[model samples]
Target chain A: MDPTDRETACFEAGVKFGALYHQFAGTPVSAKNADSLETAIEESIENQPGCSAVSVDIHTDKLETTRGYTELTGEYMDVTLRIEYADCIVHAEMEMEDGYPLMRVVDIVEE
Target chain B: MDPTDRETACFEAGVKFGALYHQFAGTPVSAKNADSLETAIEESIENQPGCSAVSVDIHTDKLETTRGYTELTGEYMDVTLRIEYADCIVHAEMEMEDGYPLMRVVDIVEE
Candidate 1:
């Protein structure tokens, strides 16, 4: 069967989530620059097609700053994305679920 | 509607590709560090579930070395991944398609 608009929307959402998490995972981040990193991540992913909005929160307190900077990972941040494809709008999120980063679709609205 | 095993395999393949592209897209790279980054990327993505193997090649000749290091991008790398889910096996690739990075499913085999 051909993929529906809703399915494509979900796939696009998954793409964004995977991209957001992996692309910045090993970045060198620290407490002092967490703010800038968060903003940069949001702006960067927003450049993708179908992505209407992106929000990133990096937990500075959880950052491993022992070396002044540590590699960023899913454990230190949470992300939400709003993706619109055709008439289907999808909401997706990446959060730590059971001590692991999980990307999931939260909702879908058709317009 | 529920997604089939093949659809889920495709979705998982997309996740790995997106994660691979985004996670390392903006890292500082040069001729010397390209090898290490490529290795790191392959090992990192292979750690994910369903990813059987990953191969990455960094085109060091394209490295913009005026600053001694340039941010990595899809333009600088070509990646191929093998993903195994349930009884389905997926082969996927990310390469330059008309000056833009294109992620695609190359083939699928079931056993």
Candidate 2:
């Protein structure tokens, strides 16, 4: 079936998120760079087709470091995003998988 | 930021797909029930708020069976969906992970 413009835009946003996740997956997470990584994530989502605003909360306050790599066995980031075509909110969580970011939807509810 | 209605709907669809994947995961795959599973997936996506039509193609023609559980080492399903908000197309692929379906975006392009 053919997708509507809004659906297309939403999916595009997800694609962008996936790309960004891969981009920052293996990077070291530390207080010195957490803010920058979060900003990059927020900007990537906001730059999508329908996204106007995005809130990213990276859980880097307690990252365990071994050598030079951040141990992400139980770390996650929360993402709250707003798009331009619907009246609901999108809440998602990005978790570490094989030391890479894997984004999944937590919920979508009316605002 | 608040998500638009379309974004919410799209995320909802993904959630549904994930649930359905879990439901059908570990089930034996064969010609006997491939059609039914595909239908269930399509219906699940189409029932979402913005989705109108969905195409689901399960790759069960060459499934390898061991005991009763289907070995999904290299099996995948393709889903093409349409929603009522954008002029683009959403194409995704679902692969088996630990005998369950894991969906990922392939692309979103103008149709």
Candidate 3:
């Protein structure tokens, strides 16, 4: 349900990529909420320069709320953005303890 | 040559985590260069708030130079920091196209 042509093209253009995390709770999520969450993430990343991929997925349609993170990969930058949602509240954390330009998604895929 | 106990403890404390990319270039990289790169990354990530992991690896020591991305994951944000290096010059790109809090390394590990 993620990964699109526009996003793939961006990667070819050196735009890089990223995707939202999803958890499965054995139930379905509200279509309205899911759409809203997806829209918010898409617009946010798209607004950033050099951002190539912005995707979201539900862990479990029944989990009601999901917890996860976002992946971002640029030509020289790579990191993950953590996210937790509950009661309609979303919190974000930036985890880059490893160092600058750590593991590239390219390597992760190719390796 | 990655994932240490202190870093592991930080994750246990909710510090979040990240890792550098390595491409194995066929030959081994200089110990001096490797140490410097590793130290720089370790210190930098350890300095950040909510940062819990800092690790580095060589893709291919014989490649002369390597290209990759850094991964960061916080409680609510997930993203990648792209990096390109050649002739000792490192270029970084931030790829957050999809949105906020994309993929959690946890899911990538467990899934």
**lDDT: which candidate is best?**
1
Best by TM-score: 1
Regions of model 2 farther than 4 Å from truth? A4-6, A68-74, A86-111, B1-111
Q: Count the backbone clashes (under 3 Å) in each candidate.
A: 3, 18, 78
DockQ for the candidate 3 complex?
0.03
Q: For candidate 1, what is the TM-score?
A: 0.70
lDDT of 1 by residue, A1-111 (tens): 335566566667767778888777788999888999999999998998899999999999888777899999999999999889899887877899999988767777889
lDDT of 2 by residue, B1-108 (tens): 454544544554454444344434455667677888778767865664556777767776666645443732325565555544455444555566687545544444
Alpha carbon lDDT of residue A64, candidate 2? 65
Of 1 and 2, the candidate ahead on TM-score is 1
- Which segments of model 1 are wrong by more than 4 Å? A1-8, A26-37, A59-72, A107-111, B1-7, B26-40, B59-71, B107-111
Chain A TM-score values for every predicted structure, listed in order: 0.96, 0.62, 0.32
Best by DockQ: 1
Candidate 2: docking tier: incorrect
DockQ of each: 0.30, 0.07, 0.03
Model 2 C-alpha lDDT per residue in residues A3-91, reported as the tens digit of each score = 44445445444544444444444566765677887888688657655567777777765566555447322255655555454554444
Q: A20-108 in candidate 3: lDDT tens per residue?
A: 11111122335445556545655664454334444444333333334432222221122333221221111122223445322222211
